[model samples]
Target: MQASPIYIPSESMDADAYQQPMPQTANTPSLENPEDSVDDSTSRESWRDNKKPRQKALYLDNDSAPEHRLSHTLQLVEELIKEKEILEANKELIRCVALTRIIYGDGHWRLAQSYANLAHGYLTLRGLPAQAAQHAESAKEILLNGLDMSKSDEEKQAILGTLVTLYYTLGAAHLIQNNGRESLHNLQKVEKILEELQTLDGGKAVVLKISEKDLALALGRASVLQNKLNSAASYFEKVIDYVIMTEGDSTPELVTIYQEMAKAEQSRSKHDRAIEHLLQAHSIAIALYNKASVEAAEAGLLLAKAYAVSGNYDDAAEMYFAESLRAYQAALGPDESETLNTLVEYSKWLVQIGRNQEAYKLMNSTCSSHLKTSGDFSETVAEVFHLMGTICLAESKMQKAYKLLKKCLEIQTAVYGSQHKKTRQTQELLNMLQKSPTTSEGNKTR
Candidate 1:
């Protein structure tokens, strides 16, 4: 029996071949007019000069043969997807379902495959989980019926490939919708079918479209949603191992995996293990991209936060915080939101560790920068004023505290209005500062 033509790998097919005109034969209709055909004796150079390149038609008329329409639409889908026109490709996929039904009737496995492909496209390209699940359920019903009627081994294998894709689509859609139990159930079905394929192939590795690493990651995420931390950690570990084997340990791909593993460890209350994973990710990011790169800055910030959360505030947290701030400043200039935000976080950390003098200086500089870049009425400038005022209050600098708090209140009133919670809080602080004993002493001296 001939192998199923259910799927053709787009990469393996020559795009140029599809662009060329099909050869005219008794069975194949010619798109060109016979009167327009040039004489056979015409010079090749003249023919080349006179002939215009035919524009590729995107859609065929309903009168065209269903097989021809299907082939053309499939090629169009491949070209659209390659060009990253995912929305157009998805529309073509919907058309493919109709064409497949026209050619092979309702019960054929190819129709099921078309629905499965549409479901995958909906989920991955458009992020429409409900639509994806609806289409996938349709594919599942058809596949179950096809499986019952299948007689040949090739047919069974072909149906199984579509089933694998269908289940994966359903699993991913459910996962996105936060239906963890349903997601895991569909993903486990995919796993079972994969194992069955492997067994059928005599234990050789079965080459499915979905990679082992992606499958493991999806399962890990689903496990996490289910609060199965141990299972999630194991699956994430498998992903890390697979990635290291395939892409090397120092690849940037490992950074996200390490961070995910760290989160899982943190959820399990294993702070030390979480720190270790974060450090690994931070180091890898710094090595792969320079310390001044945004990637490194983000990784450093996460590592710094992890250190702070673990109470390693004295040296390690401070060092990483400073590193992150410097990196953010270098990658995105000092006036950028990321740089200012990192400065605020690091200043807060400094204050937490009783480095009040340093925190005050940083906040003082940030206040000036924020005022210059964002204006005095901006929330960021208001925040800088508030922090500086609180730092002054802590150190008994009542005069400076009163000045900063007054400025904070002014900005808060302008930006958030007097009735807002932040504005009211700033107003209360200013009132308290006015009633301080030091303020009374300073007033008497003046």
Candidate 2:
């Protein structure tokens, strides 16, 4: 008989910004544990407060039977994970690890699998790469030992499935820690084992929790981190092929992949290729959502930045920047943070091209809008005041610059206190304006 499969959660494996639909499988694995009731009276927030007491109660209720306690704890782990209580789920996973060791001994593959699952939870659920790496290493040691002792083909296959997840977790954890070489090495191991499993199953891909697309994307990212641009592009191409074959060509899922490809091309100084990928992404955003939508605005912002960096497409850059600003204003309102940020970025570009007067006018109006929306004491208002002050200083308007910097200083002092770097910087600017010859002449005349 085949060993009972342990299904690792694959919900977070997609590299795209948007989630793709996963097929429902009938053979969804379940632990054969007796059902235990949990108190549902407490809200999710209150559960944290009552956690210790509830855990104590669980142990006391099943104190005589380790099996019953393990079963109950495992059920709780499932419920907490489904409820998005990741911290609590992690704690339960720790408990599961200990219980698995007690019930099945240290050399058992199930104990190793528990450790692997916990490691995955640390990386994926909590973003703790160090803890994930530590646990994953432990899982690998135990798993390799167990693999050596396995007799049946079914048992070996099942253990190998767990090994796939274990290696994938290690790769992801190392990737998060920016250890690209280690990450790529572990992911290559995953690919090799997967190939081995396919060969064992008559030269076809085995059904595993982590899909081929996920592996391709992970490998691509690891390759990019390792500065292997050609290898990265190849893996990304595989991802593109997989996505296109699985989903249609025009799906929004293509947008993130295209953006990532553009970034890789940009890193390689392939500006034309980068622009091509960005243009495709922007066109898809426009076609899938309206031009005025937030999605289109974000895509336009990226395309505009790429054009600005190319230095030969100033007019095109400005046009897209203005369009993005307008789209953000229309979709999210004039005073929303996105609209304000887009306005600021456009103004910065104008200033970069020596359109100081236009940039000043734009920022002056934004100051009023930010004051009315985010209030005078907000960081956004302070930033606008600082930018306007800087613009006035550049234009030789000493008195205006002095007043704007004074306002900026006041806001910074109020929000960030007198000793803050921004407050001190604003004060220094005001001091320079005070000592200017033009300002002295203007003050004497007044």
lDDT of 2 by residue, 361-443 (tens): 87667546565454647676677778878898988899878877888888899999999999998998888888999887777
Q: Scored by Cα lDDT, where does model 2 land? A: 0.74
How does each model score on lDDT? 0.73, 0.74
- lDDT winner among the candidates? 2
Residues 192-295, model 1: lDDT tens digits = 87765543432222234456666677788788888888999999998888778766899887898888888888888887899999999999998989999999
What does each candidate score in C-alpha RMSD? Answer: 10.5, 7.9
Q: Candidate 2: where is the Cα deviation over 4 Å?
A: 1-12, 15-99, 125-131, 144-150, 177-182, 202-205, 371-380, 411-425, 441-446
lDDT of 1 at 188: 86
Candidate 1: how many backbone clashes? 0
lDDT of model 1, residue 431 = 76
